[model samples]
Target: MIWFYERRGEHLRCEIRQQLEGDQFALVVTMPDGSERVELFEDSRILNVRSVELEKLLRSKGWDGPFARDI
Candidate 1:
């Protein structure tokens, strides 16, 4: 998996790793060097997500937009 990083605040960071298996999307995230960890979102909520709007949500979450520019 590729490394995904985001600036949470002025100097905070959120790191993530993602992958897809079968019909589900697997996502894991950690903040402040694994201080607060979250993982295994079943992704059932994404069933009706449209690509265009998904991009917008990512931006709002401080994702830096995309892999190319963010990384």
Candidate 2:
């Protein structure tokens, strides 16, 4: 899998990952407490999400930082 990630100081981090096979994707948000919330998506759902929606999803999961694009 490949990840696109952003860090918010030492408190939080979030990453979006795509599998090598390209069948599914996952969003992983890491909180200050070192716990993670991961959600999996089908290819269509992942590909169809807009940047705004992505940020919203992150916020809902407790990440209050700007979104980062995949490098």
TM-score winner among the candidates?
2
Over all chains combined, what TM-score does candidate 2 have?
A: 0.52
Q: Candidate 2's C-alpha lDDT?
A: 0.61
Model 1 agreement with the true structure over 1-71: per-residue lDDT tens digits: 33333455422233333445655544433344555544444464652243335446656867663443343
What candidate 1 gets wrong by more than 4 Å, as runs, is 8-26, 41-56, 68-71
Q: Weakest 10 consecutive residues, lDDT, candidate 2? A: 1-10
Per residue, candidate 2 scores C-alpha lDDT tens digits across 4-65 of 33445545556667768767776776766789888777865554474458667766865556
Question: TM-score for each prediction?
Answer: 0.32, 0.52
The all-Cα superposition gives candidate 2 an RMSD in Å to the true structure of 5.0
> All candidates: CA RMSD in angstroms?
5.8, 5.0
